[model samples]
Target chain A: MFLWIIQRDLLLAMRRRADVLTTLFFFIIVVSLFPLGVGPEMNMLRTMAPGVVWVAALLASMLSLGRMFSSDHADGTLEQMLLSPQSLSLLVLGKALAHWLVTGVPLVLMAPVLGIQYDLSTDALLVLTASLLLGTPVLSLIGAIGAALTLGLRGGGVLVSLLVLPLYIPVLIFGAGAVEASAAGLGAGAHMSLLGAFLLASLVLAPWTAAVSLRISME
Target chain B: MAINWFKYSSPASFYSLAGKMIPFFSVAAAVLFVVGLYIGFFVAPTDFQQGEAYRIIFIHVPAAWLSMFLYVIMAMWSGIGLAFNTRLSSMVATAIAPTGAMFTFLALWTGALWGKPMWGTWWVWDARLTSELILLFLYIGFMSLQAAIDDPRRADKAGAMIALVGVVNVPIIYFSVKWWNTLHQGASVSLTQSPKMASTMLTGMLIMSLACWMYAIAVILIRTRAIILERERHTVWVGQLQEATQ
Candidate 1:
């Protein structure tokens, strides 16, 4: 059931490539704008890079949350899914993973290139990428709950951010902290472990919450 | 004889019960506020380090405690409402949000007032302050989420789910002072250990906190009564109550 949902969503996303590209471009543009805004000072940009990149990733992930269930909901597929005997949580988990695959993976892939623009050392750049690799999935997972709750509500896009962003703080702190720690010659292990922990915890928890939220919203 | 606890779970019965209790709590809160402030402003000795500015702890500590305390209570009511589909519990949860948010804003404001005098700045990115700010955001989010949904039942359940999810942060906020050695000071009063402050200061702060509790209960009960009428307006009991009032 999980793989089927992922495959189905991937195919749908592939058919409308612009939707996926838009989120990636948003991540890139937001990251690129920082250096321009802050001036081209290497020392400052290097320090600012981790936080800037992580925050952009957070926003970009949030922007795509609206797409998680709205289309299916509008077309009445969501009602069908809810009626299905299979657990709704599994279906939501698959959608969250696909969301990460489409939106989160690109940012993880792009962070290193952006890090270079900030003059981040090679080791810091690697840490930035590795941190995003673990961290962005958690964003998608937690965001799914927000998206599900605000499903079909007016002003849902803004509402989702208000509901979800505070919850995202620990992820933002540790995600950016990993890169900063690595830059300072401190091992990124502790921060990385915390991010991994967040990813694992959200993986277990968010889908179920989102599933319950879907039922509430749909009813 | 066993008490029928579920009797007041009905909105109609709870409405009158809440009305009867409000005056007692309101008077207690008023009296406690006077006593707590009297001791807080006059009787408590001036801190050697902070001088007279430290007296804001009387309000700050209570507001901060209630902000976190009410969130837990709100979530507990919300959780009960969700699991058992109880209407009164959900209404109580709704009523608690504004007061909780007020207390949160009070804590932040008083912390700022206290901070300006003691720390030489109005705010810092200390763990406790940041977490408290997040707590305010969580309260706002809960209220807004419920406001956006048109169906009251859907609003209740959805808000309840988010409330339960956000409950994890309360513990983090409570422990943030210990977890990171931030600029914010540790607890002056704790359950396990004796308080770290002078006895009079402790007494005044406790009384102030009790005042806050009474104030919160009085306010929440009144709000919940209003909510009951608004939500149950179509019912026969509400219609009869309106006629009786007229």
Candidate 2:
């Protein structure tokens, strides 16, 4: 059931390529804008890379969060899913997983490329990629809760950002810390381990919260 | 005889109970604030280190503590409301948010004032300050979510979800503080930890915290009364009260 939902979401997402592409471009533009705002110093960019990329990634994922439910919600498929006998939490988990695949995975794969723009070394780039890989799922999972909560609300996209961004802080800390530690030649072992623990914990908690919110929003 | 718990869960009964409680808390808060401020300004000797400027800690620490404390309380009210489908609890959660946000902003402002002389900068992204700033953002988020929804009950449940998510992530603030310090310890910046204070200073700070607690309760009660009136305006008791007041 879970894999089917993931595949279904992926198929639906594949048809709406512009939305996925927009998230990527928004991330790139936002990230590139930082260097322009801060000046062209490679050393400064290197130092700021972890924070910049993570924040941009966070914002980009927020863009895709609205798409998580809006389409199915509009089409009434969400009501069907809610009415189904299958566990809604599992369904929410599947949607979050699919969201990460469509939006988050690309960001992870593309992060090293951005890291290069910031003059990050190969080692630091690897750490950046690893951190995003672990961290972005946490973002998607947590974000699903926000997305579900705000579904059909008048305040729209920016409102979800207002609600969800604060919850992203710990993930931001460890994810950026891991990359920053690597950039400084320190082992990222502790930060990565902590990020993993956070991811696992959110994995259990976020979907249930999201599922409950979906039910409430549907009402 | 068994206590009738559900009676107070009703808006009309809670309204009268809250009305009765408000003046007592208001008086207590006023008295405590005066006592706390006197001890803070007079009884506590000038700090050996930062001097009079460190007196900002009296206000800053309590506001900071209340900001964190109220978020937890708000979340608990929201969680209980969500789980039990209780309207009054949700109203309390909603009422607590603005006051909590005020204290968070107060904490940040007061901290900045204190930080200037001690750190030679208004802000340094210190772990505590940064986390408190994020907390302000969290409170804003919760309130924003509540305001955006059209249906009150839907808003309550949706906000409850964020509140619960926030509760789960509350520990993140502590972890982020630890991680931030470790990540920055190697930097040349020597943002000093606050020095150990005199006993009088500690007493004053505690008293200030109590004052904040009383103030928050009084304010929340008053606000919750308004909320109850607005939400239950169509109820017979509220209508009768409105008629009597007019």
Candidate that scores best on lDDT: 1
TM-scores for every predicted model:
0.99, 0.94
- Which docking class does model 2 fall in? high
List, residue by residue over A193-215, the lDDT tens digit for candidate 1.
99999999999999999999999
Cα deviation of A196 in candidate 1 (Å)?
Answer: 0.7
- TM-score for chain B considered on its own, for each of the candidates: 0.98, 0.90
- Give every candidate's TM-score on chain A: 0.99, 0.98
TM-score of 2: 0.94
Q: What is the lDDT of residue B245 in candidate 2?
A: 59
Cα lDDT tens digits for candidate 2, B1-117 = 998868999888988999999999999989989999999998999988788998998998888778888999999999999989999999999999999999999988987888778
Residue B132, model 1, lDDT: 96
TM-score of candidate 1 to 2 decimals:
0.99
Instruction: Specify the highest-TM-score model's number.
Output: 1
Give the 10-residue window scoring lowest on summed lDDT in candidate 2 chain B. Answer: B182-191
